[model samples]
Target: MKIYTLEELQEQDVKDVIQIEIDWSMAYYGKEEIYKLSQEISKCFNLDYLIINLKGNSIGNEYLGLLAQNITKCTKIYNLELILEWNSIWNQGIQKFGAQIQKLTNLINLSLDLRINSIRKEGALYLGQAISHFSKLQNLELFLGNNFVREGAVMLLLEIRKCQDIQRLALEFNLNSIDDNDLQQFGQNILNFKNLKEFSLDLKQNYELTSMAQSKLVNQIQKCQKLTCLKFCFENIDQDEEVYQQILNSLYKIKRLTFFQLSI
Candidate 1:
């Protein structure tokens, strides 16, 4: 079997690379080398789609902030992934780097994966702020695994939804940290999303997704006209069967919705 590395990717004369996975190799290079190589690679490929997998040694917030600031020159970037764990040392770095990173204006699809923990709240906010600069963005998936609480996550959601161009959104809540009040606020924020075509959330795994929570969520979902696909996992309600049936019946008016999955 032939082992492929980033260096090997540099030699390839490909124009549009899709889902090229780079993992443990990041740890092999020093910061300077990593930075330089990333810059060279950005220049070499006329890439429209790029997927980065940071699966080994944790990528600090500072490193990601810097990479986001410098790599915006690529004209064809439509999809992006920057997944890193919560680094207490790097939390402050995200805000500082965020202002510089917002230069990526052409992105149409973006996926941000931030490890959930108390320390990541501010970093996730900074990351969301960075994404609002892309006016052309259509698909957005923000996975805030364990980083957000009610206030921080809600604020970020409200800000990101302001981008009228977005069509798809996925938000994951930290079940342990969020409660009823948080879900209510999140429900209120969802009302602001005007153009979404696909919406998904992992709300059932949390403490706040009760029958009332489901009612609030359903009420908000009814407001969006463009929504086509709905996927949500919520708490087991008292009337699970009847509620699910009612929810599906109400959504039938949406002409674009071809797939609907709701779980308790």
Candidate 2:
């Protein structure tokens, strides 16, 4: 993995760069600098994979929007990852970022680590809408743990239902305000991805999910015929041994699942 700073990237002309990891976690740049860097990346037409690490950065809406706007110019990028954990990104910034994300139709694998951000329902909704536009996406990993998510969970599930080609999905929503209804909806929506082979969910610290909801979700998951691997973590959920066994039994029905992991 080659690491590049924004200054170094601006001076060189990148060509046929299949993979890039930009570490901007410690660097602070103004909007003009961000825009210039974006233009430089946009010229790398052969870039197939990109990772932007902004962890611990104080980036807000303007920086995120500028980054997204410039990154979307690379129409051939197949895999994209963004590490924005602990940033100051809010709903307005997410909205602008989402708008640019919708233009990247060639993405096959997408990973986003936005945990501890200031995202709310509106920001989550915008992200959901943007994800629905990825017609070619197959693998997705999203980490939004500790954000202010409520209705956003439902919006995300609804939009996820539109991605018919998704094969592997991992979602983390720990410490959010999601409830039984949200899980129920999410469970039902899981059936939409007929091609899904691996599924992982982390709902630890989400106190609203109860035994009843867990049972319902397990029932829905059993309907996934193509799943080969499954991992579920519900560390803080209030549930008894019987309920946990019932969920395990439900997983037993998936004959295709070669690997199964559960934590309660």
* lDDT (10s digit) by residue, model 1, range 215-235: 666766866778889887775
CA RMSD (A), model 1: 3.7
lDDT of 2 by residue, 136-207 (tens): 999999999989887797788788769899999999988888888888788878888889999999988888
List the lowest-lDDT window of 10 residues for candidate 1: 17-26
User: What TM-score does model 1 achieve against the real structure?
Assistant: 0.80
**Alpha-carbon local distance difference test for all models:** 0.64, 0.86
Q: What RMSD does each model have against the real structure?
A: 3.7, 1.6
